[model samples]
Target chain A: METPNPNIKMWQGNVACAEGALAAGCRFFAGYPITPSSEIAEVLSLRLPKLGGNFIQMEDEIAAMGATIGASLGGVKAMTATSGPGFSLKQENIGFAAMAEIPCVVVNVQRGGPSTGLPTHAAQGDVMQARWGTHGDHPIIALAPGSVRETYDMTVKAFNLAEKYRTPVILLSDEIVGHLTEKVEVPPIESLGLTDRKKPTVPPEQYRPYEMDSSDIPPMANFGEGYRYHVTGLAHDETGFPTNNPEKIQAQLERLNRKIERYRDEIVEVEVQYTEDAEILVISFGSTARSVRRAVINAREQGIKAGLLRLKTIWPFPGKEIEAISASVRKIIVAEMNLGQLAHEVEWATRRSKPVVRINKINGEPITPNEIFNAIIRQD
Target chain B: MDYLYYLRQDKMPHIWCDGCGHGIILKSILRCVDKLGWDKNDIALVSGIGCSSRTPGYVDFNTLHTTHGRALAFATGLKIANPKLHVIVVSGDGDATAIGGNHFIHAARRNIDITMIIYNNYIYGMTGGQVSPTTPAHKKASTAPYGNPDEPFDISRLAQAAGATYVARSTVYHVGKMDNYIGNALQKTGFSVVEILTPCPTSYGRRNKEGNGVDMMRYQKENTIGIEKAKNMSAEALAGKIVTGVFVDKEQESYLNRYNEVIKKAQSGV
Candidate 1:
């Protein structure tokens, strides 16, 4: 076993994300430079070749996404990083990966946008987009990291979920977390739990690429592994050939959906602080959660029963958990850097069980702790 | 080597319409692979959306039928990840030049070690006779009901200018030469493109009063001028003629080779 690096260093979130991907055994990265997210690509370009990995600056975001998926299918952990405009261009290929069940990670450093709204500034605007950006009914797994350290940790987790579920996973970090520099302790690589996609155990002749045996995920075969099988964006049967039959299509869609749905417990993660006996819950994620955390502390000092529920895994939305918290809390104050994207999700999850309030900021700025505190006090 | 072994026999009766030349191009590719005696296991066939893209489903290899025009992008990733595996991207004209135009030029510029075979049948046959990037100007298409207003792209020249190491053009009518070109492309170390002008009889032929597949084949044979022969011909003589043959062949370090050099340099801490 290799000894873990017991070194403490100050690093930016984007740099941490690159280091995290390297530690997670990601061997391929294809990306086009985009603001806020470009640092991740820049760091990986310098670091990957040294580690015997490959990195290519593709011509566009579509090709970047396509290349990452291809590298994953070719038996390597692969990733791409982009901001809003680039992320929009990647939607088609993202859908392709989702349909073909390719394991890859896409890191979108959120910027304000319907179209390039803010380049260097932060916004949690892509929350709903991360869940529904790709035009399809396929399952999605999105993780939001609140700090530099979490950016590093969640990048590794994103790759793990991608490999585990045989789907594209998104690491949705905003500009604040992406560019923020903080001290983080580097742990040993071995101590980090890693998951690789399962390969076919059967003989090459008997192997079916999409054949499932009790589990929703089928063992994936690499391109040069001798087990030649077809992969397509079209709905395919167990043999991995496109099928138009309604029953087969339904079954295939169900299997893709259930792979993430059935494994929701393992995929969905949230951090609850002081919510056990609190009357008000401040639900937030990514960089916005940083301010919410400080606000919760400030609210407690002011004699208000306020707590924070920070979401780490945003998609496969922790609806049941939110519902449970809503049953106890009198009101849910969802604070974010967008126009109440996740707040709407919280409201839908609560179903009027508790009143859900939104404290949104979309002027290309981070939500301050005082703003969150003010919202909390106003709710009281 | 039995070429049949490289086919998914169970998926026989492919979706291509009668007289479609995609099958001929596909067969030529298979024959070239057979001629080279490559291990089927070490080959990966990739394609974008169209009649040509469906060829991967019938071929017995690790095949990827990707989104429209993204085959080269996907194949680039696959080839770079596993340099030992031979990657081929088969695409249609529109799929390669329209939506995927950026990838095509960029892939050529990088000179990645992948074979790109474009089955340019002039029209988008699968999409119900729409005009494509290669559809000749004034040709009738569903979108261009009166006539196509846009000029066609010279795919081989486009690739050559974009820095491909090996670039060639052939028609489905010239099956033997098409096979040879494909084989040469597969053996090349850098980006190689073989743009074969296949016949879209059902969509393009019937609409343009081109008689049938046989007439289109005859037209290709009669109108195509060899590169060498066309060099001496007058501009007027070569105007309506299809100039076919190899346009570019030069040796250069491929993207993978250059990347490997970087890996070595980095690993040695130099």
Candidate 2:
């Protein structure tokens, strides 16, 4: 008997993100209408409300983020999606979630921009921005998906990491992945490893909102649950009150950053293909990663000994793996949608700037395999 | 009548000046919360950094005093995590319209069920009275010492256009009217913005001699013409003016409502 292939269906990456978010128990979505990422909000806006969830078309990206935060506190998994301009608007709030140690997923289907530079075009310019745009020192998790299938998978992963680590997680997709359609098979929701925010185990009177136990992440309790505490951006002690004391500030700040950095083993993820005994490594992420892999295959067919290291998670740099691969490879060519956002990170990781080349593109199009191959050829 | 008694002692008298409109707005907010007879514990007051952003500390609730220009962003996360709690965002003029302008518009556009109260005292009161996006043109502030070269923003109109399900404007002087607006904004099912036309008595008030806190209120009372009344009037009559009232009130699918719809669809599909 011949069994029909079940995973054969077409859907845009944005739709996959919505479906994945729903599977991740996201019942709230607040976002504005922006390019590429709009479909996630569009699908979720119609989808969430039918499931006893909430959806709000916020006044702007800032308020969309605020509304999402409010709904999250109301005990629903919440998210919002936007592009470059909206992502820039969301940095402060993202920092707020980081300091407050609140868990939520923010999807940025990145478009060209320093400031709305290109609204409808794809760009990977936000890589550094995603890491440090917020005005504070705190660790962040950013996942980049290269395909529509990965969009579904990574969205679930983004929410999972957010809840598990008690931090905001960014799904750093680009316009290509956001708008492109592909076939994806989703497993039953019952089989998914869903994580919810940890609630306080102690009595309300004994609850300390920022007090950590064994885990650096403190147990969370929603408002109306009688757990009263303060959350401030000013460096604070475990009690969550603002303090300028050097020791207290250092300890608090260290804990906030270390909570994610120390757990990089669990947070950092990369997809390596044929890196073993290779002469050149193609480094890329998001939609451009697909092109890099194809370039690697094309290079290999020409007996160039090229391989691919696709970064599924862009933050925490994946420095160790890149370093290890760099030690074995003859050259590392970085391909991205921007001029050279990831190239700098790649150079730092390898510490050999000459062999590390950047295939830069800012014209609002995906970097092609031919361009990446040409970069490698130029170096050779 | 010492309503200040309700404020959280740990946060203290705060950074507002003697005649700052933020104080009046804060008092009115507290009064609205008090009049509602809601449990303080049930309130999760969230704010972004700025003068008015300090409000979460003055009240006894599960407060999240977040970063600048991002209060509404954090509020969105909080509300979605637990939709049952009353999530209130208190923000300043610059914090709401300048750095946080994106969030302000998006929160309204999303119509997420949350209440946003902007202490629009015109100037950025806490930061030595700089000209904010909401600061009226030709007004003087630290940044606009020669005179505010930029035109001020109409926050209420911006929010109304941005898709807030409930939108209104009030001032520190109209404490009772503000309370009603606040209550309605909070009670509404989607995003609501109550632009409290608070007087920056120290900044906006002092430079313009808009009087002290008392004069600030009187100015609001005298200057504000109702939106309904202005609708029949000419633009010339309403020029150099702000019309305040419930400018928008309507119902559409809220974020949560739409979310539940998807869940139902998924359930039925399953």
Candidate 3:
């Protein structure tokens, strides 16, 4: 990655993500205004049009998701940003994008939730929602950024993964990191390894929107690309037309999952530090991970053998990594703002081999480093 | 039968029920596009979930069968993404004006260049003739077993009020006018709405004593008034009459044209 702009400049996390989108060749954004996440839309609104791309403030969150998918199908990299309430509204179309295999990014700035719990406040309560928000058995790729720099990096990766897998990728940012300002070295556009969706190798007459003999990811043909094809929410055959045949529909369902699942090693990313000969492994992600990192460092200086595992990829959960690390570790601590969303996943991943401790806080405040540090010292 | 070139023969026969008037509207849409000499690839046909939304399944164009009541929103993005693609959304009465009403009015407000073809059968036919936003007060729907008490919406008037550049209405019986209005709406450079009155014999007609599809067409022919003729009729005399024809027609810069202006101002170092 050509060294991320080569200089440090002060930028808000949302601003950095917006700049990253522009640098990553994202040409379209359709969004609705909501708390915490509105800055992403506001910044993109000003810059996308300048690049001869588009940015539309849609009627609602669902409409924003619809427009994002539509723009992507029209042959452009597209995204939409929203907070909790808006994320809830976009679930239907998010599932539609999953079923129809449209490449787009949805940014959900985590806030206090359930309903309109806390809009402006910081809380990482949307982890479970981000993974299973949309209905049915489907596949999604989500990235969580723990800092301003990672926000830029992950936003670019979100678009790349979405295009690469022909699936909707989520950049699950929380309120604290979303509003946080820090120095980031942004890379130039030419330096980034941007990826686009694969196009058909065959002629338009023989083009199938969802067909691959060996590769799970199918080549996508845009609406106006002289390949007249159908895209539907219903279970569809390889030709992109709705089908009821049990064999074809079963194959279609399996393909949607396998496309991303088979390449889990490449899609999953996590930051592991000091896990060698460690007794207590601390696991966290996004804004909460920042505090956990500090606590882990403080734990190390205090003569306690502690390690930090900060997640960059939330979905296709890093089970293998967690399971492997559990062999040497005496116990694991899963810290998050929510009650037990990712902690549940951690427990399932470790298979109860190591006792797990949860640092949970759902109040409209961040999980402080001292709080996590206390949990680190008190644990026997 | 030359219009058969536009049909995806392999995907047929369509899912529409017997005596359903949706096929008539579908043919008119194909006829209009064919008459315009449009390349099949240039046309993007989008639809929400309904019997009418099923029209896209039979077409050989760039078709999209979207989630219920989201055709216009999706089409808006497609149009904005590439201002050159002809994006046409076919939504049902319930799909467009009920669940999808907000998107409908908003799309018109932007005046984006897209043709919205509404199949107004006055009932939610796909869901077994439930009461829809356009169901007449006295019509019998499944939900309105004893007759609907709520007033119906005038779709053409709604579009005109919401700032759609082209607005027209025609019945399935008025085949020529339906084709003409669809063609006109397709050619317009802003958000255009053409609501065509069709029949739902299986669900609505059986409940409303409106007889079969032929009987419904007969009623439309007898009780409908052209926009020109309705001008002379008093409000009292126009009661119970389906007013048909062009309601709004004018030109303005579409959403894309105005957005291009935004790009100009953004790029300029002023």
Candidate 4:
């Protein structure tokens, strides 16, 4: 008298992330164990070695990021996952990858923090820190997903963007997304398009490590391929040598910054719902987007015309789309776990006195749908 | 021949001041690597931000130019990802032993297979000749124009005490000996540091009235005693003397070797 349910399955967001990384050709995972992100490292530690991939639990977050960069150089798609305090500990190495232009994925399943705010609770306080935590001026590609399915999809995309741009791409998940259990289909690895970093086509003797021919990304070659190039944080010339020449420094700096800026349209990918004729708009990312979606539905039932702009890509700020929406919408409400982080960007993008309301709760807790609805109602 | 052929020459001639000892130390490093005949692909170079940390740009290798005081962290990652590659780090005194002092000690304690080459110019050269942890006491620098009030770091001692498997010190003036010491350190199985006492001729030299690169080299030549002699000397006798030689050489399993043991033990279902 027992019947198995064909459509039912159980998997946590962390497992989905691990499986998605495997699907994305991630043969190397270097991460220290931390919660709620620890499940990712735990599953990866078990699964990676079985598949002939490398999984190393480094001593700390710094070493974790460093190992991922190293494995990427060895021609493997590599990634590392961590939570709040670990993410803060990893900024220096993440910035290193940014400056060196190493292609890799860093998954930060954010918990509350200025410093270790919440280890187990869910919060999105790292929204601003993800963009500006690293020292110096550099571009970052960050993705946030509200659901387990999106975590898998976005983790794959994060790898692709990193490879395409030759920069570190961050997957900004919160504890809610990383630990929430849901059914996810693991696609056959070959069905997905995985990107390996571009190696120089020229002979090792003729290669220029950081010189771009036409594409924004310069051709790169890994170690043991015989090609060699230096990487430095200092402003350098096309050949990647350190320079003090103001003109060369300026050119290098601009190139580093603009390589991502010029491709903003291609870089930014967002999900918009009911925004065409909306008077009030809700902007949110990560797990907060789920609450915003619920709030949008609640606002509609209350006879208020509300829409949701769920940021799938959180960096390069999506200025054009945000600007376009701000011009047409009467009010913009930003819902996040931190006070006035993405709200600052919204204000900057709108330029005008756009009445942008912030629904922030940073006591290691997520903002509920009621909070988002109230914030919108207050603005209304 | 352009000795720096592998260097990103197009980005040069370079930003180092005239008569700076960094150029000389860099040359020695490249020469050692070349002479060893190791494939450039098998070598990984990492550096933190500073005047000497810029050395990674001149060598064609798998390279990472990381944040200030964190080259050790990046190099540790590189070594862990593929322990087969020879990982080396080039850091400034400030970058390696000051701001990044915590990472440096931990790497040594863990005995990771990384070679750290510290360019000790006694001052922060790139940031304009400020006093550094390696700056001798009472020495005048841009930040300490009146005289450095802080005690100087005996870097080799600190590293050895931190559990580094191999540690050595050499000056830019001793190019031949430096190449030998550096080569041996690179060949060592675990964490090693070669504290290259280079001269910041433009800043440190000018401030201290050492005349130029030549004068700085002469000062080093006269002040340094061999490690054997240093071992027998009293603190008063060794007061103005710099010791140049290998201080620690021992065998211990590196990070990777220990990790492999864990993997092996796990595979056996233990």
Candidate 5:
């Protein structure tokens, strides 16, 4: 006896992500075409113009990323989407965004990698790349969505975090989730609570772009807003100019990490299901989490104690969450579509305390529920 | 015009070596902006990595010093997202033609409203004078000790071929002409490129025995050919001569204007 929601519709993961970005006040998108994530650019190309937003297909992924950062500094939310190879091409600009503290979102629809391993396939190979891809000790925010609806929600959350932290956030979607179809009820655009970067409250002449306050994040003034300032990829001081002084360099580098580390509680997110008395724990993420849920349910039905811990935020890695839940669970299993990418992290998070087993697949396919369920039933 | 009004005096003395013509090209830009009466806040001086890339930091505009060879890419986004802002890109021969060649041609093909100042100093002055794409054949650079093997690029011609609405070239020796060309490029409403043949005397001139900065400026005065005079010259006569004049200037649909039409059409839902 429930009323049918008129907004409910069948949406693909990539489509939902595009709609999510629109709903979250993302007005600029510059991207190149690649499999699995191409729909994001296609949908935005048609939708953004109608919404008075900007959408452009740049010359390549490097330009796409560069534009995304530029558009963000131009005082609008911007994003770009690509597969594995394109993602690699975007790293230098991504590092630029990190160093300059520009607010933008980068979507990496995970395909198999290490030089185009599989284009139209599911793989979590770029998980580490998403964290350390940009060749520096800068902070990052990356979220992996497990299903169609979560893709939409996480896409919104990704933008919010980007604005909140003044850093680029990665919407890490795999080919499986990106292509999957499921029911989604999109909230009205006005109803969606979106976050914008904090604007400078001081007079334009007195504004400093990187002057950190008590909140650790400085107000970002838009370009052409009368607050003329400098932004550089080099190590810069609070005034936002390139500086090579050792003391100033150390302070600026520390402040970049401090801004995110101080607020890790607000940034990290995860989901735990049925772990009250479970003896076996399954750690999973992205599309693999969808299959792991099914296997966990089957393991319970077969009278084995099994529960699921799904990672929503991939970096800053939720290591504390694993350690907190380690006391009760005797063993932990990581299931994914790559050859032990997150498994390595799970082992480290547990600090060699649990018997961590990995169920990895590198083929152009999703990890099957049977494969994970069989792992749960087997002892040795 | 008072130069200090546009410059961030606190950031100077600048890192440019004595007699390096980057300062000359920088003055031309400042003069052009002053003549136009454009608000400093409304201009974004974006640059990629090079000695010329440091031009943004010296000015009181919304400056962005980006990575190597990606200034055009960044400026494209800044302009498209906010059409009200005037985006100018400052790059060098290596930054513009070598590492940034792909973006250069594509930005021209799109015909976006960005004024590019290509300071063709013939070598990588910031990274210790490696041979750049514009380094003349048989020129001595640090990497080209036995003389450069690459033919130089005619930047103004390249811009004309790549669909730029305005293209011009001048050398630091011709300061008045450089300012005139920079002013004309700034007034245009499409992709405009002004290639300035400047000297990197400390690295490039010292290696090639071009004498000092004064000697290099004297060479530019002697070797370059004005476009009008070159009309009657034979191919062999113009082969080694640096042609300095307007190559292309015309009206065309800029990328922003065309994209605005797309937005209007999309809103109409026809």
Candidate 6:
């Protein structure tokens, strides 16, 4: 293992993401260039090969996703980075990785859009899409980072979660945090807590690729490991063959969902600051959380008690945490770049116990601290 | 006699319909593997969505049935990640030429060390006879009921043009020849393509004027001309006939080989 360099240096968010993936033991990267996310690909292209890892610039986003899944199956930690339009194209293969239970990481450095709305600007419009973008009821884990340093830490968390759960994890970033340059301290490789998927314990003849024990996460046998098995996107039995049996289908779907649901507390992470005695609570994530912190500080100085709830794990939506905050605060303010996407989730979790107000921006710009401060002070 | 060792006995009664030629192609591939004496664990069978894609289910090897038209893309990743493992992709006409057409050409251009066998039945068999990219003009399909107007793609020529190091074509009736071609493909160090013209009897035969499985076999035997013979035949005489032989065979560095060179250069800090 290489010694950790304690030297602090300025780095872009996307560059930090690539460094973090390397620190987390990602050995294969397949990506197609898309704005606000290409730096991760560009840096990895130069860096991965030197480390004896592989980097492939695939023909398109669809191929990039496919290649990442394949590399993961081959017993290497793999990842891909893309933006809005590319993320849309990757949905089908993302669903494949979900059904096949392949471990991989996907970083979507979000740009504005329903379709290429703004290639170089910031937007958190993909929050709902990240959770339910792929067509199915499969479980997904997505992490949102608030700063360049958090981008590095969350990317490492993303790979660890993906391997521990044996599923694909998404690192959701908007253009603001992705492009922002900040001072980051590079941690030693040994300091990062890296996790790998559990390998099967049985002999080759008795191995079943998807057979679950008490943990619900089946051991994944790598290809060419002498335990030959089949994997498919079709609803399959524990033996990993296509099955249309209603009972088997129900069991398979339940296992996929429950693996994450049962361990939601461990998989979900959030940053809660000054919320214990505050009357007003601010809910924010990703690049917008940076401004929300500033807004909360300014509001507190104006004699209004305010706190910020920054979501680190955006999916498996920290409902328990939100419920506790809703019970304590008088009003909940949700600020994001998109038009009230996460606000609806806050409302759903609170069950209307408190008023949930949304401060939305959709003109391809980051939500500024001043804008959030004004929203906090408004009487309505 | 020991051929059954290659199969997963529990997954018997494969989903391929009776008289379908996918079985013959699968058997030929298995024979090639046996002939080469490859360890089963070292081979990864990959496929996309089609009747032909169901092959990975019956074969007792590390198999992946990926999304539609992306088997080659997936196989490319598998091969690059572990260069020692042999990756083979089995795809149908529509799966290879329509949805996955871009991946097919790109894989060829990179010359990745993968053997891709295209089962060209000229129609989308799994979806009930939709007009595929290789569906012959004037053939009736569910999607093209009134004498299809689309021209078909010559897969062998297309693969050769796209830079596959080894390219060959053979029909189901030419079983021995297919085994030979597949064996050669497996031996090649770069991207190798073997286009197998198979029969989708239930979906394609009844819709066209072709009679039955046996009749389709007879048509294949009668319509295909050897490449050597094709050289002497007039253009008008060989217009509808399939030319069966190797189109391109040469040595070139594959994607993994070139990538390893890059790794060495980058690591040297030169």
CA-based DockQ, model 2 = 0.48
Tens digits of lDDT, candidate 3, A241-342:
888899999998998999889999999999998898788889999998888889989999999998999889999899998888767988888999999888
Off by over 4 Å in 6: A1-6
After superposing the true interface residues, what Cα RMSD does each candidate give?
0.6, 3.5, 0.6, 2.6, 0.6, 0.6
lDDT of 1 at A187: 74
User: Order the candidates by DockQ, highest first — what do you get?
Assistant: 1, 3, 5, 6, 2, 4
Best by DockQ: 1
Q: What TM-score does chain A of each model score against the native chain A?
A: 0.97, 0.95, 0.97, 0.94, 0.97, 0.98
Return the TM-score for each candidate structure: 0.98, 0.81, 0.98, 0.86, 0.98, 0.98
| Docking level of model 5 | high
Q: Is candidate 3 or candidate 6 better by lDDT?
A: 6
Shift of residue A72 alpha carbon in model 6, Å? 0.4
For model 1 the local lDDT of residue B211 reads 73
Off by over 4 Å in 5: A1-5
- Shift of residue A169 alpha carbon in model 6, Å: 0.2
User: Candidate 6 chain A — worst ten consecutive residues by lDDT sum?
Assistant: A2-11
Q: Give the CAPRI rating of model 6.
A: high
TM-score, predicted candidate 3 vs. hidden true structure:
0.98
DockQ of each: 0.89, 0.48, 0.88, 0.39, 0.87, 0.86
Candidate 4, fnat value?
0.54
User: Which lDDT value does model 5 have at A153?
Assistant: 90
Give the lowest summed-lDDT range of ten residues in model 2 chain A.
Answer: A66-75
Candidate RMSDs in order: 2.1, 4.8, 2.1, 3.8, 1.4, 1.9
- Give, for candidate 3 chain A, the lowest lDDT window spanning 10 residues: A1-10
Q: Please provide, for model 2 over A146-171, each residue's C-alpha lDDT reduced to its tens digit, 9 standing for 90 to 100.
A: 99888988999999999888889999
User: Candidate 2 vs candidate 6: which has greater lDDT?
Assistant: 6
For lDDT, candidate 2 versus 4, the one ahead is 4
lDDT of each: 0.91, 0.82, 0.90, 0.83, 0.92, 0.92
